[model samples]
Target: MARPLRFRRSPERWTASRVHDQLFTDLDDNLGATAVDPTFRPAGEWETRRFEMDNDDVALFIWDDDAAYWMGNTETPSALWRTDKYDWGEVPYQVARWAQRELLADLHEESPWLEPYPHVSWFFLPVFMSKDGRHTTREFFRDHAAGFPDAGRDEGLGFYEEFLSTGVLDEYRDEMSGKLGTSPQFDLVRMSSAMAEFTAAKLLTDAGYQVTPEIEVTTGHSLDFRAAKGNHQPLVEVTRPLPPTQRAADTAVAAVRETAETKTSGQLSEHGGGAVLFVDCSSFHDDQWRAVRGEQPEVRHRPAVVYRVRPNGHAEGYTKGAVPLDLDGAIEWV
Candidate 1:
């Protein structure tokens, strides 16, 4: 899988001739790239050139008297040394904005079908147009229906587009979106697990809590989320069970219990309590989910929510012990 775009620093000093021999030669031979105008004036001493290639590949080269940086989706030159990878927001403002605009234009141009969902396009730009994760990530929503066994591509995309448009998790975009991964090949189980976080995030916000993700604790581990409502804050750890057919568990009920038990015994146990567990059964189809929901079996953890959600905006579940957040509005108590 290809990595997200980051700056690669070159030790060798740049000359106009050197840019052609060392940089342009590699990209042109590899991707048939051409140096073109970026249209925007750079903010500093760096002279910038944008290279656009066939098959949706691009790389931006920026250099000044002291240093040269390469940021793009193509093969990096061997001469350039990789620098520390910063989050998308941590990159320089001008460079980040420039890369975003260029990549977004390519995204819309290539996948015109995604143009309607502006929020989804913009929010997932980092991953949707990432070097190699682009096709696999986009296909997860388009073909897999975002892990809904019974939902169509549109239903799944629209469901997530709505939640993302709320901008509740926008601040944590890098961490949250990267969870979907950038594998070159398609993977259903892995991609679905990533969407589970999105589902969990929606539940947290809809239940009226200001949510922060990847919360660090004294145990030297990070909890999935921290849900804050008024003065109350509850740590939340979310997990999703494999459908009965995919796992060793014989029944859907058993699948729920078995999967939940794994989380309860691991991180939650290590934290020594004070966190709520969320077991999401969104991957279950109607009949499979009905079995789990009917029984509402114990997940072996206190203050836990066992729920199944549909792409059509319906969610129902049962809770154990006393749940800290007010989830009554979003989750129909069963």
Candidate 2:
């Protein structure tokens, strides 16, 4: 793992000979990268060139004599001194748009399975091609079923594809996708934990409530989500219990209780109230969830929900206290 897909600005000013020297002499010889024409060029004053490697890695260089920018999924050229990285928003809007289009085309061509799920791919392209998170992130969906148990990659990808296709949470794409983490190592628990936010977002959106994530409260803490419809606005904090095998908790219910308790006692405790606690047991097996569902144990917070969701779009749960949101449509009350 390297780093997130971002603008690696060149320290030295661009010249045609240096650009050619780097691409042909260094990248071509060592990295096997060859210059290729991009499908759609950005309409701008800056000169742009595209390079691709045999392994399907693509890099784009947008430069004028004044400055140069490098972006892609490969090892950045060693000759070009890369300094500060730029998030998508930090660069010129046209450059970001052009890079996204060019890379997305190459992305779909290499992994056709993802083409049908444009929204999901487009939303996560930053991390999906990130230097550190790329392989592991793609593997999560392509191999690990995107964190679903007892399911294959297609089911998991399709489940998210449908939800993301609705565009309900598209406005939050940049920050939300970054939550998946662009660290250099594969940490399933950490990555899966980030996805719990998406699962919660789907739940809130499916329930017809507008969902906004990372709501900072007066307590100087940021809650997971805010669900609103009309004048009704409720803060939501989501927690996920590891499956029985993954945690030391003796049982699934205990796992749920313990995880939720950790959350409630931390930020929610400081916030003092009016938040809904959503206990996501999606990682639990069928048997594990059934046992937890049998007893809606207290999670040290009222107005809390204990729930599990399946890839087929079915969810069931029980509420501990008077939940502010009417979730009958989104969850099957047990």
Candidate 3:
């Protein structure tokens, strides 16, 4: 069974008025009065200003024609422009989003820009805060700057600052949005096992084999991967050894052998080409691998080749029955 996906709500919510006030507050605090143009823009004309937020230089743009605000880092001037257009009324939300993304970046977190929603705050701040008693933006304001004129600015800055300092943003994102997180469509253990299989598929790709992961077969079981070159297309099943216990090793080997026999001897019977069982033995030692490999099981129909991959990415092939082709050379080819 897989874990249920969890949804989180942002601790601080921002409205248009909140964003407007915060931007101006940031402008006043960082760049002083000269940076902001007191003169109003003519209809259809736009104005831009450079300011600082938490010591980082930022750019603020106001489009009078559309009544929108665009703010981003001055260094990557166009980076924030790619975000969805924010009406002047939505400037606060836009700034809040930008601050969150920037803070995640500073923390070395992978924060992809998801579609923004109105009235709903999506920033997950607590996940990014340290377990230690480090002051988050929220905490700073609550503790030291409680009397600040603009509470929204402090809250927004605190959320982002805490995110940068804590560094759990990635984990939070994964748990909330990653494949194995909240989705009920996939089993967690199955997804993890598939990842290992995909690793083998990646190796096949690196070896110049055109490989596809998770190819469905008639037997209702999907082949882990399928690799092709010219007219040769071989079904590949990837297996990783179980725990070091003898019973676990025996069970894993039997499962692999049974799968190979059933698939190749049944739906794949008409095709002369055999299937490959790629075993990832990275977790195993020589003795463990030898025990896991065990005595070669008998195959009734098409020849099967068992390939063991080492931790350092080397592979050794073992053949069962009279395999006419050079399976080892074929695997290592290219």
Task: List the candidate numbers ranked by TM-score, top first.
Answer: 1, 2, 3
For model 1, what is the error of residue 10's alpha carbon versus the real structure, in angstroms, after optimal superposition?
Answer: 6.8
lDDT of 1 by residue, 1-334 (tens): 6665555666457887888887788778877888888755667776778887775677777777876667777777655645545666765666667667767777888888788888888888878878989899889877889899988988888888999999999898877888888889888888898899899999888888889999999999899999998889999999999998889998999999999999999989999998999999999989998898888899999999999888888899999999888999899988
lDDT of each: 0.84, 0.83, 0.41
lDDT of 3 by residue, 1-334 (tens): 2222111112233344544465555555545422433222223333333344443433444433244444343222222324453321234444334434433443332222212211111333322222221123223323322112123434423433333233322323333222222222323233334334534554565455666555777657666666876776777766544334423334545645554556556555544445565554433345654654675454444454555543233555466555433344335421
Clashes of each: 0, 4, 4
Q: Which stretches in model 2 have alpha-carbon errors above 4 Å?
A: 1-3, 8-15, 21-33, 44-46, 53-57, 64-68, 74-84
What value does the lDDT take at residue 31 in candidate 2?
A: 75
Tens digits of per-residue lDDT, candidate 2, 141-229, equal 78778888999888888888888889887777778888888876777787778888888889888899999888999989999998999
- Rank the models by lDDT, top first: 1, 2, 3
Error of 2 at 136 (Å): 0.6
Off by over 4 Å in 1: 7-18, 29-32, 38-47, 53-56, 63-69
Local error of candidate 1 at 293, Å?
A: 1.2
lDDT of 2: 0.83
lDDT winner between candidates 1 and 3: 1
- Model 1 scores a C-alpha lDDT of 0.84
Instruction: State which candidate has the highest TM-score.
Output: 1
Which residue pairs in candidate 2 collide? 1-132, 2-131, 2-132, 3-132
